[model samples]
Target chain A: MSDVKTTALVWISPSTWPACVDAARERAPDDHVVLLHVGDDRIAAEAHRAYAGLLGRGHGPERDPGSRLEALSGVAGADLLEKAAHRLGRPCELLDRHGRPQEEVIRAAADADLLICARDGDPERPGPHSLGPESRFVVDHAPCPVLLVWPHRT
Target chain B: MNSLAAEIVSVGLLLGVLAFAVARPRGLPEAVAAIPAAGLVVVLGAVSPADAWEQTHTLLPVVGFLAAILVLAQLCDDDGLFDAAGDLVARFCGGRPVRLLGGVFGVAAVTTAVLSLDATVVLLTPVVFVTASRVGAHPRPHVYACTHLANSASLLLPVSNLTNLLAFTASGLTFTRFAVLMALPWLAAIAVEYVVLRRFFAADLAVGAHPPKEAEQRTVPTFTLVVLGLTLLAFAVTSLIGIEPLWAAFAGTAVLAARALRRRRTTLPALWRAASPLFCLFVLALGIVVKAVVDNGLDTGISRILPGGESLTTLLAIAAVAALLANLINNLPAILALLPVVAPAGPGPVLAALIGVNLGPNLTYVGSLATLLWRRVLHEHDSAPSLGQFTRLGLLTVPATLIASTVALWGTLQL
Candidate 1:
């Protein structure tokens, strides 16, 4: 009945997975927390499809988009969700979507009450790229409120 | 030279400097910086350097206090004290973009007021950018808020940052008096900025709002206390020994830098780099303005244009002109140029004008170090609305600040 239960998707970045999971346990209700990500399988498929289009080759074996990232993200997402559920002493669902990372994350938000993201990443950017377009796009159009979780500043 | 010839010569030379700076400003950040200090030097060179650089033993305590304050601030930041403070603000605002903007501004004001603006900006800019992405809001509004906070917070204390430090020391205003002039106008600017920016930010953006269960709470093994004690001790010792204040500051910074590292914890290179452009600009302006004063004398005809016997009236007039000039020429030279000529204007005009010059940058991109840095970051390799973006912001800010500033000056004198 409170303001927080409406959160629908909890997205975890690899570095911040620990912190986001912890925030969710405290704030998200049982069953309200869904671990969602754009599976690497989906991204891989997109790349393959593009390659085939360029070369005019026969249809390649069906490949999921972001196949590798999806696998890695899946393991990370599942591990954190399980750890969080255990800590909260509750049950939670792991929702994975195989597509471009941004689209899948948006779709997950559509089904949930709120979207929570853990802000765990390399402190400095690799070069000048900061807040890639996908993150910027999702922020502008997410279906519901999203929380940016970080190690609570001092 | 005849008076007319001198006036014409001043105008011609002034136009030349502006044209040259405009023709290409980016490549010569250092030389552009050197101009103000160099100009100040020329002015002082023309005058009695002994008088312009004169030391009054009684004035020494204020300098010492500012140096000590910087050490204390460095310690608190090293411990990340402001992070908890940010969470508290975020918690209060909940999930609304507008509420969050206001909260961020409020916290930034206090933080920048307590520490220097550079420290506040360094700690907060990364967090704000990340937080904006999390909340799904454009970083623009938050970026604007950060800059505005710096501007408003500039007036908070004599030791809050260099502009206030310069204004206070050059004009002989006290700490509490400086804060008093700044309080209302600073708050008003924050309120206006938040209100204007509210609708433009993302809709109820929230970066993960919860804290980690295991977040660290340990204190930084402190050189803060040691630094503070040493700074104060040195300050006292220096005044007794009659060391110049600038040299004393440099000595303290060297002493602290030598011992600040713990277990090879690297000192933040960003700390020195973050505000150097501004410091260089200030030093450079100090040189130029001193030179100008030497040529002009303490009461050039222009300096006495107020035509009023009232100290308050004259003071306000000087501050008003100084603020306007600072936008084009920038505050360093503007303040350096005016501080000696203005006589003692009570803490009122001195405080108000200092607020105006520091905040005046809000009116244009080139106005203050904070605005210029933001402009560069946002523009980066590509130009986003270019310098014109800053000019527009300044157009709004200059009139708004001046109007609010006039009221503050009037009220201060009334009280």
Candidate 2:
């Protein structure tokens, strides 16, 4: 049989990046790993709404705090992805995206053989409660197999 | 139509508008709900066109002030006044979380008192959050200070809050007098807020001992600060000179907008948008809707319930009722509904109601637009406080502030 290298996708978040990176390093050391971080725009949208609600609409893109915030988030997401890549210690593709985190993760995982992620909530419990809505959505709808791990050792 | 039908239609329309505003369903602008509801009230004969016109006339100055202040606040933000303030706070705090909290409190109180609570919530909250994070301090206490002071510290001046603007008009107190009268109550409320918040977030403030990595130096926007100071002084000067404070607000906005445009910091369209014509329209429409409700006898109902006296006990009762109404139906509408009834009693009850509507909103997110916006800011930072946590802190702070401020108002009126 011809040997084909497996490709793995790891979802990295501020709280769960360490655990996901560890899992990727341990289980898929020989595989091609893609580190993905999605910057959620909900905060920017909320900021726009707040500016409009009280201060009135029509704040141009330059003056809008939402735009600046989105820029900041982008910088932050890039930094996170860099950190994750460094921890992986092997050659990896770093992917930075902006949108709904779960949807972005799912879409990024379509071509991968396996997806690695960490449970984002209730780390002490081992039930549905351990996963947040985003993680739950990713695990259920991922195009590839998911390796869900706790954010920390339980 | 019949009196009963008019009352039902007016009340129903107002409630519908308020619900839309509070829920902001599907992220619709409040004007989308308020404008149509206002038109419906007029179309249904619940309010006459002439009555709507009169209400608009009465609200002209308040709306104008609001628009100018919004523009002014936007320009100040664009000029980096808030960012500079954040940098200053960070350096002043020297990486101590407790000191950062106090710095936030001082800046937030002064910002609210001078620039209005909208500025504090929209412009200052993010700045404070960024400052706390940059200084390696837990942001919870500092950011919480911003929202709490936006409400509690807004009791200081007529320009500080929309409710105060309305109450200022109704009370017939000069600009200086309004500030003088409210100063004591404002201080009391701020003191109570600081104490309660310090205690409530004690644990969060206890951590974060690391100093800033490299305290990025930002130059304070001296021009903007000077203009803001001059504008505040102009507020009192114009009030003393027998002109509406809107002119001062407009002049200040014009000066700042001109400077911003000249420096290419903002576009003309951005300046126009900053004036927030749509929001001003919302307030006018809301005023018309509220006027219809009052004319249909909401004022009479409130009058029957409100105690009639300037005594300390009576003032406390008025404040309590105002706080309850504010929490029940949002501060803007609550003040709109209560003002007519309270204004007829005298300046004492009107000021007391102002205290209640301003400080009372800290009790719930729905109680004020500022609180709702503050929540959005926190959510953006991924630090939104849970509803239970917010309510628990509110429970500790709101009543204490409300009562303390009301008592201070009573004492001020005596003096």
Considering just chain B, what TM-score does every model have? 0.68, 0.94
Docking quality of model 2: it rates as incorrect
lDDT of 2 by residue, B218-263 (tens): 8889988888989889989998989988888898889988888888
- Provide the clashing-pair count of each candidate structure: 54, 0
Identify the leading candidate in terms of DockQ: 2
Query: Which pairs in model 2 have colliding backbones?
Result: none
The positional error of residue B91 in candidate 1, measured at the CA in angstroms, is: 4.1
Cα lDDT tens digits, model 1, B1-415, are: 4434434444444434433333234434334534544444435344344543542222344344444445545545555555555555545545445566777787678767765665454455445544443333334455556665666566665556655766767665444455666777666666556655553232222222333223433343345445544654554455446553445455555555555455243366633432233324324334443444435443475456634333555555665676776665656545555555553645665665676676665554244333444335335634233344335554665566666655665666677
Q: What tens-digit string does per-residue lDDT give for candidate 1 at A1-154?
A: 7655554576754234555677777676554667654443322222222222111111112221123223434554465456555654656666655445566788778777778775332223432233444565667788888776543321
DockQ scores for all predicted structures: 0.03, 0.08
